[model samples]
Target: MTGKLGIGIITYNRKDILQTTISSIFRHTKTPFEFVVADDGSSDGTPDLLKQLNVPHVTGRNKGISWNRNRVLWYLKEEKGCDWILILEDDCFPSTFGWELPWIEALERYGHVNYMPEITIEIDNDITSGSGTAEDPFIAPMHQAFCVGYHAKALSYVGYLDVRFEKYGEEHVEHTQRFLRAGYGGLSQYLSPERGQLFYLRGGLDTLPSHSHGNPEIAQRNQAIHNSIRHEPLYRHPWRTDEQMFEFREEIATALTRPPVEPPSDPQLFNSIISLGGDGIVNRAIKDNFHWAGLGLFDQFLVPFHTLTAFLQHNFAGLLSTTCLYGYHDALRCRDTLTIYHNCLDKPAHVHASVEMFHEQLPALQYRFRSMIQEMDELCHKTQRVLFIRSWRDGLYYKGQHRPDHSATPDFRALTDAIAARYPELDFRIMFVNFGNAYVDDPRMIFANTRTPDDSTAEEELAGWKDLFSKHRITLLQNR
Candidate 1:
């Protein structure tokens, strides 16, 4: 491929979509552009498929998306000696016009121009379209397809993509920012009114919650990756000679090391405390309500709260203890009072009301709840375990106009069983709360009811929970 324009596409797990994307690329572009498929250690037969294609591709060690793309770009520059690179996603396919003479003409008219494609989202009956341009108030469609035409001299000016952004979301924006900072301008073009269609796939958002599986090894690996990134100094001025870049990096390291600014002491106005208990309700409440104490609690509940807590403990030491304490809960609600006092200097903070879950059939919600629990656990190990719960009770009954289903109760039972089996280590010390009349007298007080069953299903659910708790040697706390 003599007159080569390197096209790099990074993919993981989604081989079917990737294959479709590549086929579309070949169909559109007969222009001599060397296709570079950067596979991020996909276990889904993608490597075999790529091998069959017989195109030049690079397989990265089971790293992340950013690293894979960076590696491919490096190969294109250093080995392939390609002039221009067009970056595309596995989910995006170009139209027939994409490879036509118009594209080349546009490039020639606007030399060294960065072109962002217009993206269309196909909903049931309607399509939403947006030109991937960053306007004043809103960000560009960062994930849409884009073309970067590299002039010979511009190659020395524009550097590689920052691999620190391992995932898909912010890397593109960061690259655009760097380009703009380097005095380069880009444009966004709507190819046609119906240029590219984004088929809404499942789990499209990167922030969707996932299960932990309680594997310490995975947790350890994640921690190691995090630590390595934190310790590794990012040298942005890569165009500088190696010695100059190293020197600049050392200066940054030194600047990062010097830090000591003490705030004026206030003896009269003591630190305030707020404790929360429940699941998503508590998590949301704590985040929305608390913002004063250095904006720490808000970030703490972001994701994997436990990991955040541990990070704070290691870095900030007695900052949390010296400040305030907020307790959030879902399972154990007994220590709501004691947990507030012991950790918060025997002074109780505001006890945010717990949430009463009425829907009993949703097992998928349990996955989100488990993720939150893991975050809390990581935070607890970091701090003095300030947020405590003695017991928690939840059950489903007819609420509003909705009727209760017998089938729905099984899902809740399964959730309780899974929780019991998974966290057996904390069984004795942690209280497993239940929303059942057999466990507590006033079911109506805990949860509002609009209708009742012929038989009390709450009693049956409580008995099942008790059996599991006993089998796991975990303490069962029932809040009256």
Candidate 2:
């Protein structure tokens, strides 16, 4: 309680509400605290209002609730050096003077506490203990996240909000569950009798003037992410690596700022094309066609395989299920490919899986496949149409060099056919970026290549691809 207290309000496109909430905080809260607002790309005069109020705030593109909250955490905890932090949504307004005292006390005792707004407060079966008295408020599962307090120590332990939760809904639940599992306390609350008695809630799904940030599709996606990681272990290691944090911060900065593109004449055309473990040909196509085309996981990476069946079953496993290499414990390498983690490591880390190792990791491969397919199923919900580009080659690495033995054209065909069958409703078009055997006579397959021997220029090859895709009623975007 003696250390610095920082209060951060997260607001998005709700200027009037945000101003009112700030006014309420000043009028009702007597506690001295450092205040900041995290603005989620508000284009609706909210930035001007914050400036007018002379409020210290962090403003960036609308990266969603979880990301906005992360900005708050980074600002208050890391930058401002606050020992205690409270995060509030713009719609949650304090009702009484000294309302923060109880929260501060509870945070001191339990390391964390979730505020329960009067309008939405309800007794639930999940209550672990406590009554409505000030001595011991009703303790229950942390369902809502409009307002929450955290001691700096607890904040450090829990880490920043998972930006993967996207816009809204289940992010709070996942964060709270993570905190609870780590053995933190104080999900206790007591509502006041009068309007704005404790905190007035005016947002979320059913409330009047409800939250303007999230849509049903986003809510469903957030729910799926939460459910998938519901049983995952709590953090001892940081929630995200330093490199990942840099990437996420960059994402926040560039959110929704991609160069504009004219919509394809056909609505069924894809907005983005991602590489699915192929060579650099698809990468070249993506870069040449779209002004804002960015790199994906498989771009510029080689996934060498002996057969289609093995590649189809274990490709994702090789990328994700990696382990430290022997004699080079500092380097992690894939079991099925020549991918080594931390390219900065100055160590010998070439990992080509032996036949014995492949057989032994069958269970790991199956588990990774199941997890991968679930993610693939979620892709259908992302866009109306998506084109996946790949190039199949039968090869293996011998002492760290790629040796092409044969063409895996048949295997690529089988893999593409199986996936097309599995997700018949999804427009999952696969483009083979190789020649000779790339021209597969299949409805779901696309054959595009830099025509060899004919000395076809990159532009000529790309034009050929566009014409072919157009014939198949698929529009390929050109440089804008």
Candidate 3:
């Protein structure tokens, strides 16, 4: 626990974002640690940029995500002897300065610190102040590997990530269950009250290969995930004190004995990413987690997000949108009533709201529909491809020769990439079906030659979607 912390980034192709991630780490993290990048054969300028930054990096020959992560662990843990390594995707960055101290401190107390949080946290100078528990800190319980810090001692027992998980998908959850089996727990039970802990960053990894949703390979990929958690051998911690060992064992027993909760089938994508532990330790730790799961991907994102924007617009007038996430669950738990002081200079100013007033204003959520326009509730459950509906030469959503690289707007990349960074298993493709004239050369967003019968009516919009679904054989679920 007293050893150095190494921030490990798994990256490919994105040069600019990687640099920003590195710069943010140096700027925001007050802790002394090694900055290492594990590159999966980036022909981009990333390797050169790393060299310029004077950071040590390992070059990979197109090995998949799982292998790269394990290799990074081997290099950092076996060769460098760091006590802990925080695995961050290349697109992630620290939202504030010295934000890692609390994370490191949490690792000291807990065996693991899983960071799949969507709500942005801002940590002030005090690293000890937190609301999470050693078992269930921040009262937020989400299972999956978005970004996580692991103690070397814990890694020794759990071993490297299962390398068979070639792309980002379920490896983290599989790895997490194994870690639990190895007698480790997340920092849910040890959050401090003194430190400010809001951090945010865009993800840097792709989720899935293009248009690979409902592909048989996904089911096969998930089998490996099942194997990782099924019966992985457990090992006693070499460094844990007797008291820690007892608590760890208790958590494992809870996980094993409790019933597992099955993820919903709507997103079909959720089935791949969410492992069902029937009311197991994870299910029981925090009740809000079920509420979270019910949020069901992107559509669920709208509610809390809209409220935050509305609050920001009304109270903190200047800021319209932010990478920062407000206390989302708190607002809901308070029955739509949220209170953030607009005039606080350094910290959150205290305030209260009436349930009636908050509800009266909450209905305005419908006006901000542009963000969700043409957006699906979920992208065909692990769909890495986007089959856009546009006219061939109509000048609607696209303009010019229809090629992906010519697409000038890979705007979908940011949307899908953000989700992919958090879920790495979801490889996405943004395809623009050229009902209009637009070029699509970017493999990430390919152009297809499909068009709707008419663009002038909602009937046409419905027909267009139906045609696309029929062509791809996709089933659309009702949006919540």
Specify the highest-TM-score model's number. 2
Candidate numbers sorted by TM-score from highest down = 2, 3, 1
**Alpha-carbon runs more than 4 Å astray in model 3:** 119-130, 133-136, 139-141, 186-216, 224-229, 234-480
Local distance difference test values of all predictions, in order: 0.38, 0.57, 0.46
Model 3's alpha-carbon lDDT is 0.46
Q: Quick one: best lDDT, which candidate?
A: 2
Using Cα atoms with residue i matched to residue i, what is each candidate's TM-score against the true structure?
0.35, 0.47, 0.40
Please report how far candidate 1 places residue 108 from its true position, in Å. Answer: 5.3
Q: Total backbone clashes of model 2?
A: 0
Q: Which parts of model 2 have CA positions greater than 4 angstroms off?
A: 122-129, 132-134, 186-209, 236-244, 247-480
Query: In every candidate, how many clashes are there?
Result: 17, 0, 72
lDDT (tens digit, per residue) of candidate 3 on 162-184: 65555656666566656655556
Residue 399's lDDT in candidate 2: 17
